[model samples]
Target: MLRSFSYVTDHTGFCGTIKNSASDFVVTEIEVPEHLLRDTRAESLQKTSEAQLEPSSLCLQQPKKQRTEPPSPCAEGCHGGAPSPSERDPSCAGGDCSASPNKKQPEGEPELRSGLEEASMLDSLLGKPMSELLNKFACDLKDAWDLENNADAATREFSLGPILDKKDRADLHSAVRQKFPFLVTVTKDNEMIVKGNADYRELCQLVTEKETSDFFKFLDAKIENSTFSFAPDGNKEHRKVVHHFINRKFGRLLETKSFTVTDVNDQPNMSIMVRFREKSWSRKRSAGGFQEKQDLYTDFSYTGIKDKKAITYQPMVVKKVTPERLKEIGSKMEKKGMRIHNIHSACQHLRLGQLKGNHFDIVVRDLKHHSHDSSADLKERISEAMENVETKGFVNYYGPQRFGQGQNVQTDQIGLALLNEKMVKAVKLFFTPEDTDDPVNNAKRYFLQTEDAKGTLVMLPEFKVREKMLLRALNRYGVNHEGCTKGWLNIPHSMRIFYIHAYCSKIWNEAASYRLKIYGSKVVEGDLVFSEENDESVSLNDKVHVVTAPEESANKYSIKQVVLPMVGHSIKYPSNKVGQWYHERLSKDELQMCKFRVSPLQLNIPGCYRPILKNVQNLSYFLEGSEKGIEIEDNHLNAPKVSLHVSFDLDPSCYATVCLREIMKCDF
Candidate 1:
């Protein structure tokens, strides 16, 4: 059947075309023919019935057009009162075909015309030439004919250009996976692509796992907290950056030479054992606190060296030793006639007592070569040399020890002798006295002057005698004597006269006020009663109110008795019990008066012991009330006064005396 078709060109109006065979197409100029439209419709219906076809195919063809005129389908009865194509079909018969210009067949048939027109419009928009549109029916038929052909391969090859660029490929995969959401997979080349939601999830899981593992490995390598950025495009830039950072930071720590990790029990994660190298040495000195002048024997157990800064001893093990070559060293010593026996003896002595042996290396120091050097220069040179050798890592060696002809004696023994002499002088100065009559005063003077005596005086029994006689003479004349006379006083009277000048010196005049004083007095009832006139004629009643004034007398007085005021006409002064009662009463009254002085409760008392009695009363009240669980109210107006009682007995043999003075209302 001849199928009519129409197409619009860029510069031409719609033109008519016709296809009679699969490959034959021709342009035509024809007027509208109703029979032809009817024929075309019949033929389309026949084609549709002959084969299983899509409803869209019925509107695939267009009506023939006329030449030099606007192409239009032949419509019947529209302008000439004939039945119109709209009347033939009230609805579209096929895909969007109702708009067709042909009026024939049925009302529903024209509906298919609209679909044909829409298809034509779409085909034109697709930029295909009218020839390709004309060949659409044949193309569709050919697709059916080549059903077994590799169409997918051809389609894929054609689609490659648009999909192959980096960005485009990624976008393509994203779109495909988003649309299909089921076909995603890792490619044979390890490239990942997703076609479904589940595939995308799997890809994401793999990526997350990889990233997590990498992150942990990175953290394991890091000693410090770090921040890093990962490439947005799944590149490993962040990993490389972190690796470099870790290596750089930790590399220096690993480079220390003095410290080494000696043992590692596990790879990657394990405890490391480390050892550090330290330089050490020992220092020895003579008992006199001086460095020895001779070479020290070095063979010794490790007793660790002292840290100069902390001045603390650190213990160490001697890992190695390099003493002087025995033959060469011994020969040199023999040339100087310095017996090896001496060195051996010193070593044995140090070993036996100090647990040290001659393990030290010997370095001969020539005095002649260093004679012109100052002491500081020599010291610096020695220190620098020692430091340099120590830094060179030599084995343990002994330092120098001092020994010589005049100096071979122990320095400590000499120090001991000097100390002994000073001690003896100190003892003599303490025991012997310039003024010896008063033994106690002389002893005090000796102690005070001992430091000034130097080491000249020696303590002896004779010196003590001289000290006593001198003290006696000074006591008699009321003079102080300088120098010890204890030893001289032990001599006979004749000899004592001879040593009098030796015992007394003009130096005594300056120190006389500090001299000891002695006195002879009578003691009565634990009190020393001095006679106003040397007559001693006064009776007790006559001396009742005669007060003995405190004096700076040369003589020392002994107190024989202490007397309290009598109460009423009590015999025996009320004995011990009454005295105790009186004391308690006085204390109580004094305490009460003290409280009343500041409190609202002012109590009165007779003369003497008022403060004492009040203090005792207040104290008793406070203690008693506190025990009874009664709170004592604070009384700002009633402050308590304290009273004190003191008594003493004198020693006549030692000439000791004490005086009591009473103070009343003593604040604070």
Candidate 2:
């Protein structure tokens, strides 16, 4: 193969230098294609005698003339073995290549070369090119480096090969191991000690297309008393062990440095507050299939929407230490799996589950943008609605999200299927994975549908970790629907929790529906009432808590609390007709109130009560210019628009949507 490089005598021009100085020569990889450096090898080497290739005869002991220019006047007489002017061959013309025969008449004392000069001479001798003198020297310095004969030692280096998928971008991961061809040892010796892929050089090269050398500077990491602190980027997640994207240059220092975590608590909190205040650039589709430009701000507000107003945020207070390492930008596309999950966990948080519910501030803005009703009309409507709400109270409806929020919603159905031990249905529902973009997964799902557990397992990419796990259970026992059903146990505990929670939510919603239907808007006797004033000892398992008339004020009809049942093994139906109705419903399905005791899975969902009534406090709203907040810009309406600026506090787990439905009288 041909290489594009000149044999220049003076090579002092190389701005690009790899951070790793392990080897004297940095091999900027030449694209030696498969045709060039394949596993195919030449015939066995013809062994040579020790006389033909002596240790001193190799490139290490090449003539000084071959390594550098002839010595200067200060270097004169330094090479004692060098022939004098009188003894020098006549071909040594007087160009300082050799001194004239009798010209040096000075009686100076013996001089020795400085250490710097000696080292320079050695470097030049070892690394520089040699002029060919084939007459005496049998071979060039490059030719003597044959691994078959004179080569002695080997060195291996690690590098991130070109990664295509961002999610599978972690170095040394199983995917990386399987995909990238691991590079090992360059032949410097004949001893042929075969070291593995893990035996790698400590340092790496980082090159950028831009002029700024900012990335070249290593991170300023300080670990005092086991607390590691380093500046994390706004784009990347904070990392543990200081590896991955933050320049692995300091990785070796982690071993020698005093930051070795001895105790579990000493593990550093790598959680970084995601920069949600800033805008993220995204390519959005506009007209046709073309992608349009858009600056999407991070949704930091707790309202769970992508509107501009939601961009205002504070750092999320994380309770758990971040266990994920920062993904190296450009290493790979992080579009799926644990990498994306971790990124989402570290950055975009999903406001779900049982929120710590003392109080939650709800900001309902721009209601007027969508509301065409007049101010007085809206005010009268809201007043009447609130009065009605004060009397009847809000329905305890678990919004569309509980069932997976979109048109073909079915997660709740899947949850019920699992709860009922309809494992096949649950597996089928789950295997038809959401966000179907990858064809490979689609194919695997097809095989899974065919009940070819083994085939599907093989076809499923390693990245389809969840699917592989379920299929592995099937494979381990035997390929059958029953074994596959048993594989549901292998699914994530969080997922199992979700299924049970969804089932509980569904049951609760139905019971609430029945309650609403029977007693339309009145606090009846034997009804469980949730009251902040009622200092009652309520177990989370207590599905329904009965209450007597309050002594604070006998005639007061305010709904301080409206509690409903959550199905559990230890729970009981409410008293009177409501309790009878719950009994009838549970009896039909052969489901006991105590059937929710999923103790074996440790998902023992102790029933809890959700308030059937929630009071909105500090409620206020205004038309466009009438108030401070009126968010018209985000409302997509021009000026003179009516934008409701409302703020109120509701306990955690209460949906703002339900309250909005009462006020706006519209389904969003």
Candidate 3:
């Protein structure tokens, strides 16, 4: 349990549990579009698929020899041959007179009297609107197949105008598939296309050459569009097999979209599209002023997919980092169930505080309220509490994740030691193991007892990389004050900064609570308020002016306008009682209010200010409608129920857990 953070509202918060499961807490960074990293897998997969199925056969295969004679009307049921005019019967309707074709007729259907009669018959089977649509499509199909008028007849393609209704288009597509076996249908942007076997066979040839062209294909001819489209003819399972086969062979180069196609025998099929993604490049001027291709693909790569569990993503800008180094970093992160995706070159590096904020989806379970209350009563209470939070907002305290969790030494403890210039104590605090009797801890205990860095290194688990690094440093430098300080320096700058930041956060939290308790919601004298230039979106920097005294009262600063500093040498404390409180807290820690630097450590704490109260953005909640309990680990109850799902957005660095704490009034 953590310390009780003060709340702004007077509403009584209900008791509930959070994060019983990983899914209970969901967080996503709200990044800017310009800085959004691309996912290289999508492009890489496409290229691989295309490379595997490069359309070599399509280019190599001889063009079909021009047919000398006209194609037979047998496909249109003219098996007996064209009848003489004198002998032609109106009932024949340009089809066979002597016998019915091998094709299955619609049940209880008679021979067509004419094209109109056939359409009329279809009008009864499907709706009139659909019948008319198919009628037009049939005409287009006939025109494309007409070899007499069009020289490039086989290459011709036409769309069966927009079929907006999915069911209607599907039914019509199915009908056409059965009616015209040689023709193919592909729906794009609600418009259906009718093509011939010539195109399909060319694609099949490419697929046959590259057995596993999964997502993309390369073509010999220059394609103006990025994607190459195809339709696979089969039942659902057969289509699935074809799709899986292509994916396995091509390895994700092909981009696929679902479209319905029916086989000649009226079985359903899958529609597939392949997008060929090449590295985008720019034209650069050489010394001669002539344009040359400059490869920009090497500059930018993408990482991450739309995964709920893996919600937080950040873009990193590295200079002079080799592929091998990137691979090593990726491998290490992956070992910890994390990943670094798509390392590519970029024109510029990402800057900190460039994002708007964070989005959170939180679930609170196992509600405990007044015992006799009904479900509706409980819901009302929950809603009321949430309403207060939405309207009045909660105190903006940093969550426990900022500090170290469990029984291990809190990050602030080490930070305090560093602030007090007790470098040896800080170093010891870092290596000190908890009371828990775990194998990893036992290894740490062994190191403490024997002082054999090499032997302990062997016993240390592979996952404890930081500990291993420290031990290795000690092995080289020996275990002494100077050696340990050097070992601490070996740790990453970001991590070392984190420990100090945690201490600052601790002070910020305590100061904020006291401020709220003494002043309530009123804006008082000596309170630091942001100038107009400094808003929630802006980062705390020298540019942001801290308005105090005359300006604070004149500006009518609200509680939300008040700011607290994260104690640093550069940052100014609040001028009133809250400011005095910071001095007292630092005194208790055996540190001066002014000096925050250790010259030898080569570290400086350039702190920033944060708003004491934050208004929850787009706050909303709903009751989970389930009688069954959510299965959770380490639950003593027969069935621990999850009742509420809450969602909101907060400014960057503001903790969702703290907001929930204000709502639930329960320590996590």
Candidate 4:
């Protein structure tokens, strides 16, 4: 049986039956009392009369004349035409009112209106049919509703003065206008005020990320009742909503905790251990769509999501770090080469009173020699190579992670566009449609590429939040690069940096390969060598040393490690045979070292030496399982039959695939 809920309010003398729709929370079927419906028509008409009489009188004066027939129905939870009493909210409007300008008034009556600051709403487009108007405002309506009811962010105590900067304030104002195209005006007086055609409280909470304390009790009560009483088989999805809010609240509290568990992918990631602090809040990875990470924690370790696929974090240990000095977090003064990106990617963490030293392991599989190779034969070959690998070492080639997956090379194209300062091309590609299965989203992307922002805005489905944001930008500002810059920049700072880094990775990989080729005469005068940097590495090189002669150069006998710069303005090119390659690459691309600048100061990957080779550690393989007739990537896996599990550990900044390639000699 489908679970349903009925609410009766003694306050409004209103009663109705509500059931959860398949779409969740939305009222699919609402049955209001017949008398209540009669009241709504009367009230809506009455408000139309009074709005013209006086704007100030809305809260203060009585109606000019009293009706002899009956009380007018309230327009409280008003959404669309002839709202049922159950949907009407008394707090919004009572008796009679026209919240929108498009609502036609009776003959010979001046227009009556309520201001936006008092309610959360969006305007219906004037002179358009109901169907067209609804389609145009579909996606934006969802955003307004989310802001108005997101109880966690809506605390009575929240305000704009404490959190937003001048730039943030301006951006928010633009966002409000963009969200509701018919929004009359946004004034700068007391924080951001969206004047017409909007829900006042919803817009306030949306921008300020706070809500009144009055709703806290109601929110808490609902969560507790729904969560504790939840049944897996219940038709109502209220329990899922409770869990979502709980997880969201928990993620916020993690900022104060010593350690936070983050969902990496298939397994628990390196973020298992971290020193949480306020400064770390600025990291791009820290915040997400559901909640701001800097938010306060009401729950610490609530693991209600039981399924393995659903839970992102696993239990891990964390310890408090006692700083010897006033350490600045989210600043560029960290011990050299300690960029935030590498820190998270390499899984750097504090251990044994110091920060990060040899503390990670990687497990790789699928190492068959050829198409028909048996599991046992592959394991024997891998075992033999492990011995030789321990002695020689694998080249530190920039693995597939550097290039991105498959033939798309989208990142490479984005990087090239960024390097050339082609902002339009870069952002256009980002919002453009690929061979995606989502036809609705793909159609919207096509509209954007064609510069039909208005068409795309209406065409978009409600869930395309990101695309809607892009279309709104193009709508407000023209559909051009100059107008679209603001929206283009809104694509998270980390994402933009990643594109540029892809280009740099390509250069680094080529240079590493070049260095290895010239190893016969390794370490000539003016040659740079690896700084013997380890996982505990942080900060930039304060001193510069150059090799003047082969004898003065230091090496670990046959180990022979060399360092290559990652193509930047501050790069140190080799003066020997390898130096020409760097100069040629830079000249061909018309890129100079001084051009590598980005926001937040830390993403600037300055000159540094990365070792050319790395040896796999604890390398071993084993046979396991079998495949009947499964297919992978359109290729049959029956021949390989799931065997040869390889386990090993590599230092930070090394790809496990490189070690595997040396052993198996096959593209993976």
TM-score of each: 0.11, 0.42, 0.53, 0.43
Per model, how many backbone clashes are there?
94, 15, 18, 30
Score candidate 3 by lDDT: 0.55
Q: Which has the greatest lDDT?
A: 3
> What's the C-alpha lDDT at position 313 in model 2?
24
Better of 2 and 4 by TM-score: 4
Superior candidate under TM-score, 1 versus 4: 4
Candidate 3 on 273-320: residue-level lDDT in tens? 444334211322221111234232223222211223334555655533
Per-residue lDDT of model 2, residues 198-304, tens digit only: 21212111111010011111011010111122221122222332245332422222322122111223333222111111121133211111123333233322212
Error of 2 at 151 (Å): 78
Q: After superposing candidate 4 on the true structure, give the runs of residues whose Cα lies further than 4 Å from its correct spot.
A: 1-380, 454-471, 520-525, 532-539, 552-560, 598-607, 625-639
Better of 1 and 3 by lDDT: 3
What lDDT score goes with residue 259 in model 4?
Answer: 20
lDDT of 1: 0.23
Higher-lDDT candidate among 3 and 4? Answer: 3
Which has the higher TM-score value, candidate number 1 or candidate number 2? Answer: 2
- What is the C-alpha local distance difference test score of each model? 0.23, 0.36, 0.55, 0.38
TM-score top scorer: 3
lDDT computed for candidate 4: 0.38
